[model samples]
Target: MIKTATRSTIFLFLLFGFLGFSQNKKNFSSIPNILQQIIPNDRIDSWVLVYNSYGKNQEIRTSGGKKDYTPQFSGFNLFPTEDSFYYIAYAAGGKMNYITDLEGLRKFVGKIDNAEEAAIVLTAEGYMVDEEFKDVAGNYYEDTANYYLDLGKLTSKECPYQKTHYALTVSKSSGDVSKVKDNGTYIELYNKKCANNPRLLKIQKKEEPKDDPKKSTRRK
Candidate 1:
């Protein structure tokens, strides 16, 4: 009788353990396999994971405020013919950091193997392009030339709306972020029309001169 009771207790424990393990596995598998591999289990549980067809967005509330995690290629229209690039972003504390060149992402997520394959899986989810800026006068513009002009006008006391659109486009290409430039027309427009604005002047000062001063200014 004693032996039978011990055996019965052991059997029940094993059965319940198996069931619990199976349930956890099922829950984990529900997430995209690539994400399941990339995000650590604890972080996955604590963060609210939001998924769109394009990629995953994780939001976590810290003592400071909310932080968002999204794909590296966000805000750009990805062409199907382009090489697959993969990256992760952590945005919080008024700053955004991209993880691609280093092993930080893999280490943080606890996944080391099959990174390229995982990126392909995530990219397969979708392509995204952000919206362009539109002026109060109802004109839509892509580059920043008209954007800053309209921005200055809107911020003036004369305009009650005081609204302007600003956004950054970041893309990952061959394990590095791509360089984005304003259209030449936008640059010329900003210089001619909005140069007087303090903000515009600050931006212009940051631009490096195109020609080498020593070469161009030398007696010729």
Candidate 2:
């Protein structure tokens, strides 16, 4: 009788385990459908792994406070004949980054083996992970919620730092977390949090240069 009871318990545990796994799959089914459509093919085999990683990990994590992972992913179809969406992928092996620019170029952020967590490290140092972006094709994807701290943890005077349009087209040079007088790094401002953040509002108050540095000083 004891043997039978043990066998039944083992069976029930496995049954519930399988059900829980299936439920998790059901929750993330949409991610694959959306990502697969615009995934690039330059590194076909590696990108396959990234897709699998997305399926397994479909959520973001917060640590400490607002200083965790916040690398923005931005891109669109470079051309109608090709499909290329740029973003950072967190995988069991590590993170795979597809850095995209406004010129419609897509390339790996660094070497596959040595590139582990490069995006997170760079962003933490003030360098924007994304290159430049124009999401005309709606391929500009954002994996992070852009909220470093949860609502319950926020103080009364503090407000969540919301990314404008999910920071889709924002880009900055390596090691540039602060503002420069004439650095051409493109930035998307917060549409919602400026009212609550006086410092951010002051940054927004900077007038756009009439000369258009991107057109005059920068190259295409």
Candidate 3:
């Protein structure tokens, strides 16, 4: 019999795989006023922010009256707006970088030449949260209440919030973004709203799993 812990690990692995592990579903929450302040004209319904704790640290002053400080590192934030575009911003290494669209994000990542590809790549690495949802039965569901990402061994023992990583996901198109689990559905929606771009088609093709001849023969 499989151990309980092993079984749990297996279950989560399967669940993540089924949901396209990189797509982190999240619940809707009010975008921070600070973030909203940055983009006043655009209407944003969803967003994601992740701190890259691996970078160089800086001293942060405590809020209390006492003069105390702590170390903190900058990270990145991704958000989609009413317009068919997403924004990526990063503050690290004593420098700040912000990009308003996929093309700019491509330059920031300096990896894939394609903008859509770069957007997907950066989104996978960041924390993701989804918006609120209501089923046909009129039951409302939300994910922002108690959801957290387990950093596992990467979690710091000294930190108060152990094994917790903040993340979120925002849909760029219409319909219930929270229900989108696999890459196919995501790409389908992307195409509908963004006009079936060639790069996204390439990503869809790549995500298709090739049939295994050996496995098929064994089944027969």
Candidate 4:
């Protein structure tokens, strides 16, 4: 366990796509017009919002219009940790639509004590409502603008105050995560999009081995 317990922490809004995690903006009720401008396409089809705070999980699921979800996650304990919190989401074959402002979430999490990071887990398919974790043990994480976990590189955008770290991730198929890397910009691997189906992005390996050629003696 990564130990995501932070004090004086508050989870504003958490969005879950079949693939990515997002921050909820419902709290910006005072600035309705402004909020819309910030997140023009905040709402999407077959999307859900998972907001956690004060030891509870709140979700809002919808096909497109009406919202349906649980007010709180029962039996799950979400204690505030050192600038951190915990959350869960569903992955429909690793394909989903996510709407959020990564920079905003990072800023919000950074404000809380010990709240410099976050994580997301896409449980095994066919058991969306089941509380038990069915798939692998490790979970995806997003500290600010980066996403990582057991798997390699996921995303690397930009976090609050320019902080970066591993967070949550979900894989539709069973596999192992090796290493994570960033090209000094975007998270190339996780940001990939395909038509008609979803695909897992991976880091390209070097064609040549790391062994020093000069050290090798000529074959006699």
Error of 4 at 95 (Å): 18
Worst 10 residues of 1 by lDDT: 144-153
Candidates sorted by lDDT, best first: 1, 3, 2, 4
How badly does each model clash, as a count of residue pairs?
0, 0, 10, 21
The per-model lDDT (C-alpha) reads 0.34, 0.31, 0.33, 0.28
After TM-score superposition, what is the CA distance of residue 142 in candidate 2 from its true location, in Å? 20
**Per-residue alpha-carbon lDDT of model 3 for 81-106, expressed as tens digits?**
33222333344343444444434443
**Model 1: colliding residue pairs:** none
Tens-place lDDT per residue, model 4, 75-108, is: 2212212332333222233345232333433332
Q: What is the TM-score of each candidate against the true structure?
A: 0.24, 0.20, 0.19, 0.20
Clashing pairs in 3: 26-129, 26-130, 27-130, 127-167, 127-168, 128-167, 128-168, 128-169, 129-168, 129-169
Model 2, range 115-195, lDDT digits (tens) per residue? 112222223223222222322111222112211100011112235432221221222323222322222323334446447
In candidate 2, which residue ranges exceed 4 Å CA deviation? 27-84, 87-98, 101-220
Error of 2 at 136 (Å): 30
TM-score-best of 1 and 4? 1
Score candidate 3 by lDDT: 0.33
